[model samples]
Target: VLPAVVDTAGAATSKTQVHAEAPDNTVFNWHLGDKGATEAAFKAARHVTRLDIVNNRLVPNPMEPRAAVGDYDQGEGAFTLYTTSQNPHVARLVLSAFIGIAPENKLRVIAPDVGGGFGSKIFIYAEETVCVWAAKKVGRPVKWTSDRTEAFLSDAHGRDHVTHAELAMDADGKMLAMRVHTTANLGAYLSTFSSSVPTYLYAPLLSGQYDIPAIYCEVDAVYTNTAPVDAYRGAGRPEATFVVERLVEVAARELGKDPAKFRTQNFVRKFPHQTPVIMMYDTGNYGASLKKALETIDYKGFGKRRRDSARNGKLRGIGFSAYIEACGIAPSAAVGSLGAGVGLWESAEVRVNPIGTVEVLTGSHSHGQGHETTFAQLVSDRLGVPLENVSIIHGDTDKVQMGMGTYGSRSGAVGMSAIFKAIDK
Candidate 1:
């Protein structure tokens, strides 16, 4: 008989008998904030709202499928891999240091004009490693390009989670605390940067835009037989937003309160608000933002619209979501303390040629996000040069020297900041 299969995330979460019950199958089990304190607050709350949220797996199919070309320079004892990658530096680091392909100085990875990544191409896969290794053994360059079918089967998938979340509230409808438990499906073997997604990237954002006094979150990540799951569009923040917004909507309905007013009541008004789950929000005007959104949507006329829809034998509903995301993965000290193996910082070098043209070498890669245009505009505006005269160079590990790559919406914020600093120097 074939071995028992646990391919789907739903099957992996079945409690009757764990499909992945082996000790090693448990990838991560960790919690944020004081569980005891949050539970006690929940017990004493005048009102409580609970929600069970399930997000299925998602596959990223970029316009261009992933491909790799590996060339070995036999005489120089060096290897060059031209592949579809978001971060060539990280790819080189993993291949040389961890995969034992070669020393860092000998292995050079180049990513050129990648069509798109959507977080899928950010990983170093077996095909690239194999191609590079085989090039040496065969004494020739090896090239492999992924077709659509191959991509669907092998590309790192994203966002498979089962979550149970609760919000504790006082009699006046003010949020007291929040408690959340999640089971993330990592699928098969761990991929690059997979371990951080459902943990640090998910739980910390559970507080959302609220002012809950206490919050606790627990995450248990497991391995299944499906393709390896990692970050996708919005990564963990979207999942966290769904949970918080759904709970808030339900809570408003149960309290016979307008969802807009209910959300406004709990919005975090103060600056430098420290959440129990390890986030320190510096500042925000949640009430103003909500008011503007409500006015823009004509929220007061929603009842009339719903009644009109009923007359037309149709259903009408509106939803509100207050989302907060931590972007620009930066400040090496912070990421280092949080278990990042590599520094999350970006790097850049600015050079002005004698002909009055500028070359800006950045670690940020552009996979359809137009980093070249935006970075060029920044340099052109600052340096008083025409946009065409400023060239943004990136992707190749040899050219860049080092980089954290582009993801988590960091190209503009973190990457440009590095370029700005270099220009200043």
Candidate 2:
């Protein structure tokens, strides 16, 4: 009945019904760095700019919608769920342990030819759980596939955040400190990996290619009467980039400085720069990258282009964005320290057949990322084998013992590294 209460703004108001007993609808409050110190520094800074970024919810429209088929084998006392998932092993684990669908040994999850996930298919949903459980009760195979309309209405959405960010700068336009307060919308219920998305996944990356001595971020995750919100594409990193870049751009404008120049001056120039946040960036060349970008885009000629466009009553403007992301997800110890419950490492098995053909089994799932070709090429290069002789297998829990899945663009960095280690062994 609460049709209008769809966002965190509404959920925070008294008119909205209390979904959970938590005060102010806050699921958790996550902060990084010293907020008090950053605020004190902001007071003494020469220039400070406050920017509010409102990112609306987005439903991922993958080429193929979610589909599931559940079958129970009576004789074997086992269940099989064929669903479109990014990680079948994780799905099997969640369904087995948390959902009580079946014991891990008695249940199998297979995700084959998932059209595209873009992070939406990573989490376990109600339909798949229902299908698997119903199959056992009815003693028959249960099948369900979401149509385009149903997919839009039901699929886990992504990136609904309201952020108030401030950047403090010195007289010379060098960034001194930054502070951010974000209200993240987790939708009606918490999805798998939901809590991490707005917290550890977000605030840690606030230092986005910048070398601010002091930075602080506080995120209040709220529940609203909306579809479950989760990761999409770049996930939390994209949102962080938006906040940082926007603040930097506006700060440059207010201080009457060149955007690119301002970014260059503030770019993390040194290696092994330990940010006040949790992230410790080991290496980057942001200044050189910006120089190359300016050259490639003909940045100096933008005034002429703008003049030409205005003569024809057109508005033309170019903007710059400096962003950084944390890919290659794990080393379980590091991720677990950040509140991740499961092991973050990916697993792979490499087998050289007696016929000289190679079979590589990985926990990483690929919808449109071309893992088959890339992994096959890698094996061919590493082992001196023909491309056709190498085969990559994935997306089946029964076949691959375990996987941490693919999100945060970790497949190439983490998955391939695991494959390389397996090949070495």
Candidate 3:
């Protein structure tokens, strides 16, 4: 459904008449940090630098496009769906509860051998929903697969946003505060975790690798007539990093200071440094990482590389952008308070057979992420089992009780952490 754009500037008055549910063409409005504190800091700053960044949306073309097959057993009032999904449990939640397709127990969802997700396969789509519902009605299996064109046309796009951010700095070039106003284009309808992506996930990381004492961020999640936008790759963190790093780089240039020196001066030195935003970074050696990176690149050798390129009638330049993310999907209570509909916790089951072999069931479904091998390695190293003797299971609702699935790069940090807990238990 194409939405009528009320305004191209993503104004609050913008209207997307595509769906009756979203009357104003707006999905959600969210804010974080102390605005009063941020404004006061800005007033006191010796320098104020502003930058506008637009993270244009793009389609993720997976090697294997989305496909699904739904099977129903009329006699037992049961249904089974073999589909391409990053998280089968999340799909079942929406299908059974939200869509009223079937009871949770009676519905079984399976995702297997997925080629790639890149955050696209995590959400439930109309094709698989209809496939399962029609199977139950006709008492036969129903199947559908998206060709490349359909996949390209229908799958959610990633990171369409317009942001205006300003950094307030002292005479010595120390950052004192930050103010960011971001207008995120959510497209026609909100995708799974779409509201959370630009709001909670995006705003919290505005602090980046710095210790900005005051940070105020506002996100206007607007609706437009286009493909829905959802989480992809680094999700909001990358966008936040882009904003912070770009602003920092610009601030350095405006102050006539070497960018590396400016960044090093602002590196967060302490463990558990809490920014004005909601994130609390537990530990990182930002300065050390910068030092190492600079050393590895050999800052002194840039002149030689540039000279060699100059001889070939080309110009060479070197630049650096330092960024840090507060890792982990983390702390369900934390996410829920920020308006998440569901808890982000993952589930895992470690089943050790009598034959001394191991089977690991994780809530995470892999699409070429090597989850099977990585998760199995954890079991092998922990249980003292051979890697060949360990098997990893995932992406089946009946086989695995519950899982939040992999997105926002959580499969490794959050998913495996769950398996580690199960193994410990």
RMSD of each: 2.1, 1.6, 2.2
In candidate 1, position 247 carries an lDDT of 91
RMSD of 1: 2.1
The Cα error of candidate 2 at residue 385, in Å, is 1.8
Which residue pairs show backbone clashes in model 2? none
Who is ahead in lDDT, 1 or 3?
Answer: 1
lDDT of each: 0.88, 0.88, 0.85
lDDT of candidate 3 over 180-240, digit per residue (tens): 9999988777787788788777888888889889999988887777788887877788899
What local lDDT score does residue 73 receive in model 2, on the 0 to 100 scale? 96
TM-score of each: 0.95, 0.96, 0.94
**How are the candidates ranked when ordered by TM-score, highest leading?**
2, 1, 3
Q: Where does candidate 1 stray beyond 4 Å?
A: 7-21, 332-337
For residue 349, give model 3's deviation from the true position in Å.
Answer: 1.8
Better of 1 and 3 by TM-score: 1
Residue 135, candidate 3: how far off, in angstroms? 1.2
For 1-425, candidate 1 gives per-residue lDDT tens digits of 54443644454444423344455457778888888889899988999998888888899999899999999999999999999999899999999989999999999999998998999989999999999999999999999999999999999999998889899999999999999888888888799988888888888888889999888998888877778999899888898898899999999999899999999999999998887777788789989999999999889898999999999999998988898988888875436657775778899999999999999999999888898899999999999999999998999888889898989999888999999999999
